[model samples]
Each structure stands twice: as C-alpha cells, then as structure tokens.
Target: MDFRLTDDQRALQAGMRTLLAARYPRERLRAAVDAPHGRSEVLGTQEGAGAPGVHGAAEPAVDRRLWAALGETGFFALRLPEEDGGAGLGLPEAVLLFEEAGRALLPGPLAATQLAAGLVPGAADGTRIVTALDGPGVTAHLASADAVLLLTGDTARLLPVEGGTGPRALAAAPFRSVDPLTPLHRVRELPSPARTAALGPAADAARLRREAALLTAAQQLGSARATLALAVSHARHRTQFGRPVGSFQAVQHLCAQMLVRTDLARAGVYAASLTEAPAEIMGAKLLADSAAIRNARDCLQVHGGLGFTWEADIHLHLKRAWVRACQWQSTEESEEFLANELLMDAAGENAPGVWWDTLGEENVQA
Candidate 1:
C-alpha cells in the first residue's frame, strides 16, 4: 500500500516542526530540565502551596503558561471534531504532532489531555484537563484539571477532581520515572463523586492500548531520529586516528544500522496509524519500542566516552527512550499480543509442513 503522506499532512507536519523548533528548541528543553520542578514545572502551580490536594514535594511541577500557550496554538485540539472546537483531523495528523513533541522532549499531560479531549464531552477545545488509565497518582492525572476523565478498566467516568484551584490529593506513588520531564504520581485515595458515572466503555480497551502504542511509537520514532542525527554529527566532527571517526568502517556500519532501525520503526508506526486493528497497532508498538531502545544504545556507543557525560545531551534522549519504551505496554506484553494474534490466525489453517521442516533443520544444525 502507498504510505506516502498527503500534501496536506506534509504541510501540517512542517508547520508543527517549525513551531516547535522556534518555541521549544533544545536550549529551551535544557532550561526546562534545569528548572526546579523538572518536567512538571510546565503545569504551573495550584492554590494552597503546601496543602494536601496539590502535588507533593516529589512531583515535577509543570509550567502553566507553556501549557496554556500550547492550548492556544491548537496543540491540544488537533484530533477532535471541528464542531467541538478541534482541528477536525484524525490519528495521522495526531501522530505528526506527537513526533515533534518527542523530538522536543516535551513534558506535560499530552497523552492524557489528547485522549480525554476525544473521549470527554466538551473537552475538545483545549480546556485544561487530564486523564489517567490507572487513576490518580499515575503518570497522567488531572490534579488541577478542570475535569478528569477516568478509565477504570471496562468503565469510563468524567469526574471533577477539584474546584477552581485548591490542593487535592488525587493519587500517590512511590517511585518516580527516569524521564523527569513527564512525572508520574500516585493516588492515595478516591474522593467524593463531584460528577461521576459509568460511561459504557465507549472504546475498546484494546483500541485504547493501540492508540497509546501508536502515539508512543511516533514519539520513539522522533527520539530515534534525533539520536541518530546527533551520533552522525558527532562522528563527522570528532577526530580519531588522524581522521574523523565517521571515516572508520565500523562507525559507518553502526550509523547505517541506526538509520535502518529508525526507518523500520517509522514505517511500522505509519502502518499502525493507518489502521484500527489492535494487532497491527501492537506490532507497530513492538517495532517502535525495539527501534528506540536499540538506536539509543547504538548512538551512545558511537559517541564513545563523551556520550556518557552529563554535559552531552545524548543521555537525556537515552534515558527518556528507555523509560518510555517500558510504559503503556512493556516489550513482553506486545510480544504476547503478537503471539496470540499469530496463534489465532493459524488455528483454522493447515499446518505448513515445509516451514516446520525448515525450522527443524535449522535446529539440527545448531
């Protein structure tokens, strides 16, 4: 199938890339990391600084102004219906925006907000909102959200976590994630039902998982691309053995492998985004996750000792890739899903004797 993006899609991607480059450049990312709350600083602050409902000492504070700016720019309303104050786009456009977000190493309630915007009524117009898969205290929560969308297993609910601005204990968690830019929280307890009801699981859990997988794959693709670029640039500049390190055959091979993996991941993500099937999405997630982790390692190896230093930005991508690769769904989880799909597909088909024979022969050689 032809996977080329349409001209309109290309224009959208170009616009997003340009905007992110100008507003959320690398230096800005570094500054965000250095800020007091790390990635969470972008969320701004709630009233009653030390009160219970507010995020605790450990939570990474988010920058409120930046989030509002993002909303104003239509970043949060890209995939909703036009009637609901959205750009009237779909997953493909959303994927492109996410890719730019990944390259920028942006930190905020991006996924939750996007998902919530689509699922929750009236949330499409970039209202400050947050949703959580595991409920409060997780990676994405609406601590200060104007509204909170909760996906509790087979049920969905829209609840008001707080009023206007006040400290409220949504959830709590023990350990923090490596990507401090996207902080995870733990919900200590569930509050009263300010507005709560079970919405028939409007979307399949599998579909939601696929959405997470695809969006994450887009992010990983960007990370892998950025990392590969950094490694190649470093190789071309760093001198070794009286020539640039990139002149070495071994370094060239490493960079080549990195490029191949990045391309493969990108293709997989694009394929997954085009479909609604869960298995296809799982495959995409598996490919993207593998590519991101492997490419990051390969990139780090190419940089040699310098890549390990704190000053080098390679580790930031490495750490973020590692952390994100394990989230939404682990590698093992995706593999199991793929295995199940394969088994189901083979259930009614005649066994291929030749395939088994080939496998048996390979085993015998071993």
Candidate 2:
C-alpha cells in the first residue's frame, strides 16, 4: 500500500501554498486583523448597525478579490463532480487545500464555503459565501456569508440570505470574537429557515459532518506544521549568549517535540482522509487539535519574549488554533466518542487481542 502522494496531489498542495503565499502574506493578514471590519471602517456605527441583512455595516470579514481568486482556482468546487462543473477531486485533495489554508491562516468561512459548493448556487463559483452552524449558538463569519447551512440531526437545510431572511431573520447578534479574523454572530433562536435546498437524507448529512471534521483536522495539521517551521526558523537565526538559540539543548528538545506531534497528527489526518470512518475522523481531529495548540505554544516558547508581542504571528496562530479547537468536535466530546468505540470493539466477538493477532498473521504472510 503506497502512502506517498501522487503527482497530481503534490501539485495541488504546491499550487495552494503558492497562491496563499502570494495573496495572503503575513502583512496582508496583519492588515486585515487591524482593519475595523475587514477593509471597511465603522466611523460611529453601533454594533449591529449594518450587519449582513440589516444594511448597516455589511463589510465582509474576507477579501472579495481573494475569495474570487480561490474560486477561480476551483477551491470551493474541488469536490464537486466534473459534470457539475467542478474540479472533480476527492476529500484527500480537499484536505490538502485546507492544510495550506491553515498554514497561511487564511480568513473567512472556508470549510463551510467548500462544503456548500454543489448544494448552494453560486457557491461553486465562489460568488456566494456560505457559513454553517456546526452544532448551535454562534456561527462564524455570519456577517459576510450569503447563505447559512443548518445541519439539524439527519436533515441539512440551506438557507439563502436576502433582505434580512434566512440566518439574518433568526436574530443574529454580533459576538466579540477571540480571533480577529473569525467574526462570530450569536443566533438567539433558529427560526424555520426559508429552505432553498434540502440536501439529501440522513446519510448525506452524516457524511457532511464527517467531512467537515476531517477537513478541519487537516487544517489543524497545517497550523502545527507551520508553527513548527516558524519555531525552527526563529531558533536558527536568533542569537543568545553568542550562539544560536537552536544550538541549545532545551530549544532542540522543544522543536523535536513539535515535529513529533505534527508528524503524528499528519499521519492521522491522511489516514482518516482515506478511510472516512467516523471514529477515525474523530481520532484524527483529536490528535490534530492537540498538536496545533501545543505546537503553537512551543513555537511561542522558542521565540522567547518576542512571541508575546502583538506584532508576532505566533499569537495569531495560537488564537486561531484555540478557536478551531472549539469547532467540529471539542476535546472532551472526541475523547468520549473514542472511548465508546474502544469499549464496543473490545466487547465484540473479535476481541482486541484477536484482531491484533489476525493483523500480525496477515503481515507475516505478506
């Protein structure tokens, strides 16, 4: 079984990296963070003065040009079938793209928009921005979205935004966000949405949730890898006591630990992408969330006091990781789900030991 990336996959990853580097440079990211509402300024406007539907401050949190560029690259449409005018890629490809997005800390409702491609009109072309309500309560980037996807149990509803309708009609109030790039809106109550599309049945909704978890895990993996790179670069150049900080044993150990966590999480993300199993996806997200958060902390440690400054990108990575951790599946929820799977497996006719022995026998024959 070959685990290596194919030529096309490698190309896709490289292309996304190049695009993000050019379009969403660190400078651009910092500027976006500093801007009052993305590129727009709220002079004396109240909190919800011109939110999405109300017509006050509808300034989107994302850059329209960059969003269009992503669409031109077929980012949101990556998984749509070719017959549907998409790139006709699979989940693995989507994961690769998301990992690069994470590395760059690209802003906006990326996962939601990507998931909306085939189901929502104009989504595939990136003309329409879509955000999702993962579970309930606050939805990220609601002010910028053209539509909202509500996943309630087995049913997935697509609510279009027009003149204070859909999610806007549900009484979306602004919530102070921790990550500057992730603008959140609190949904007080879920009004019966003007359903534009009822996407498939229970099976499809389940698949969408699973896909979301997997892609988010991939993003976490990207952040872990990026932080590891940042730490390594900073340690190599920063001098202390007439020697590079990287030369010190303590710094080396920190970097080594970051590398281990990142690689381990990467393996899990890639494996889950292939299997698409609910348990494996949850486990991947668990590893990725930990790796992303811890790696960013270690990265800050590697940078010493400099990392604590607002200008430093390390804090941004840490803040974004913290936010991502809350999405998809929380640590406790993932742990509980994995524990149930383990107990169920152990109780089955194929005991853990037996399963291991069977695997060993197969490996021996091979």
Clashes of 2: 2
lDDT of 1 at 165: 30
Q: In candidate 1, what are the lDDT values of residues 1-366, reduced to their tens digit?
A: 678989998998888888888777888888766655543323334342212323433344455566666777777788767887788888878888888788777766576677776676544545565655544434443344555555555555655554423234453343445665655444566555554655566644445656766888788888888888988998999998889999999999999999999888888888777775676777777887777788888888999998887677777887788877766777897887566556545554233221222233331110
Per-prediction TM-score:
0.82, 0.88
Clashing pairs in 2: 50-56, 50-57
Please report, in order, the local distance difference test score of every candidate based on alpha carbons: 0.67, 0.79
Q: What value of lDDT does candidate 1 attain over all alpha carbons? A: 0.67
Model 2, runs deviating above 4 Å: 37-60, 163-167, 193-197, 349-366
Pick the TM-score winner: 2
- Candidate 1 lowest-lDDT run of ten: 357-366
RMSD of 1: 6.8
